[model samples]
Target: MKFDTIIIGGGLSGMTCAAMLAKNGQKVALVTAGQSCLHFNSGSIELLGFQEGKVVERPFEGIAQLNEAHPYRKIKTEKLAVYAEEARTLLAEAGLKMKGNAEKNHFRLSPIGTTIPAWLTLEDLITLETTAELNGKKLLLANVEGFLDWPTAYLSDSLSAMGANVKTASFTTEALAFARKSPTEMRAINIAKYLDKAQNIADAAREINRLGKGFDLVLLPAVLGLAHDNVDLLRKAVETPVECVATMPPSVSGIRIENKLRGFLGQHGAVVLNSDTVNNGFFEGDKLTAITTEKLEETRLEANQYVLGTGSFLSGGLVSDYQTITEPALHLEVEAHESRTQWTSEYLFDEQPYMAFGVKTTDDFHPMKDGKAVTNLYAIGSVLSGNSGIKQATGTGVSMLTAIAVAHNILNQ
Candidate 1:
């Protein structure tokens, strides 16, 4: 198989690039090993959470202060803003509407009773600009009968401490029966799939109405729907505003958005090959010419340009064997310390050097080898060195913006 572009990972970064390129009439092929990190996503694009132990109010303003090796420093702030807005518009057009502005960050509650600062989030997410906004409001926190992801009691206590009039409610055993999974096996995805059915949604709405009365807004688990949006259904049924709190992995919000984007990409002309891992690539004079996957024996996929969005250690793009760290598929040189002891800090949350280990890249996103750029190969996402995405809370934003930048470069070239 041959195409204009072959993307080696099917996460948000690869999919966005494939969609954009295909929409512009490029023949694109997207290959993936399996499901993406989206399944574990918090369903929000966090530009930057903290800088030097201080929370960032406006992310763009801090980009200029980041170190020279930081990835954000390579991309102009204006381009970053444009990419974020474009990403929002793309997801909205695909049916997973998002909310937030380009210049500011907002706060949303996580399942563990922590507040997460994000640049953009789902429309159904509950965000409060300040704790003062909750002072005079009555709030309802909903708990699913079988799901243990959200601790409603703890959340209620936290909210009460924040000056809100808070109450806790639960979906009854009868309503939760639709989940099908036993309590021992039940999870957010099961509940979300059950809620996706119209009949089950109606039943849930009835229960919510009875339990959520007199509340200004109802905060439910993220398990509203799996492949569909059920926020409006519950809102209409209970005649009250409703929002969802981020839950544990098998994120319903993330699944919904991924489903929408996958469908959109399929419709646009990108051929997505899931459960396929690229085992080897044919390179000629610093240019990757073709790739062969584990599943295919006789065929090789050739492309004019290639994108590596395979992600970091967690996603199998980079691997460590205690003695050394290396990129598995391409054997790209990693930027890391020679001594393993220097890779980590005493405090896990501190600036750990190993967290930033990945392939070195140029400003144009091209992977570098011994100080020279690989002409036709580009790397993006967690696979790029110099940024600890988790510490900065810029994982999704980096993926989106870098993907957009790569797509723009490819199109312009």
Candidate 2:
């Protein structure tokens, strides 16, 4: 099999790159093992949420100050701004309605009630430029009766402390009640699956409307739009203004993004090998000639160019042992600590070195093998070394911008 580009890993980065290339008429193939980290997303894409232990109000400015090795440094700061806008437009074109820009970081309410800086937030979710936006307003937090993921008490206390009059309510429909019979399955994704029906949505809307009277805003868990966007349906059905807040993983909002992007790729004629793993890469000289997947066995899937967005240790992009870490797919050179002891920090909240450990790349995002650049293979997203995305709060931003930048590089060539 041959393609213009083969993307390993169908996470945000791989999907973004595939979508852009496929939209431009390039034949693309994306092989994904299973679910990506999108299942843990908070309904917000963050650029640079925190820098030097402080919240960043402007992300571009924060990016400018990032260390030389951070992935954002690979894309020129000026071009990053262009790619940021392009990224937003691409996502919007892919059917994701979002707000906020790369220049300014808005605040999204976290599952535990604190505010986190975000570059783009889902349109139906509540976002604030400042905490003062909550002052003197009435807010109602509504949750499913048996859903235990959303921390309502913490959110109420946080909102009340920020000068908002907050109230809490719980409601459940027959569908939701039926799901609650299994404690382990009462997650946001499962709840969303149960609520995909019109009757269930109407029942939920009726309950919320009864409890949400006179409230300025009704806040519900982000569990209404897994298969399709039922948030809009529920919103239109209820009289009160409704918005969604994120819940614990597996996040419904994140799954919605994954599904939408995967579907968009199909619509654009991209081949998506779902639940498939790329186990070996066929390299010749300094270039990756082709690759093989577990499902496709001996059949060599060839491409002119390939993208490795297989993610970090959590997603199995990189693996570690008692002695060393390695990029499992192609045995690409990884940037990590020499000793395992230096890979972590004694303090729990302190930044850990392993989060920044990934495949070493060049200025153009090409991975290196034996200290030489692999000409046709590029590594993007959390799979790239430098920048502990968790500490820097730049995971989604890096995933998106890097992917888009690489897509441009491939298109230009």
Local distance difference test, each candidate: 0.83, 0.92
Give the alpha carbon lDDT tens digit for every residue of 189-284 in model 1.
888777777878888887778888788988888888887888887778777778888887878888877788899888888999989988888878
Q: Give one digit per residue, the lDDT tens place, for model 2 in 344-410.
A: 9999999888999999999999999998999999999999999799898999999999999999999
Query: What is residue 145's positional error in candidate 1, in angstroms?
Result: 1.2
**lDDT (C-alpha) at residue 74 in model 2:** 98
Q: Candidate 1: lDDT over CA atoms? A: 0.83
Residue pairs with backbone atoms closer than 3 Å in model 1 (clashes): none
For candidate 1, the per-residue lDDT at 80 reads 83
Q: How high a TM-score does candidate 1 get?
A: 0.96
- Superposed Cα deviation of residue 412, candidate 1 (Å): 0.7
> Best candidate per lDDT, number?
2
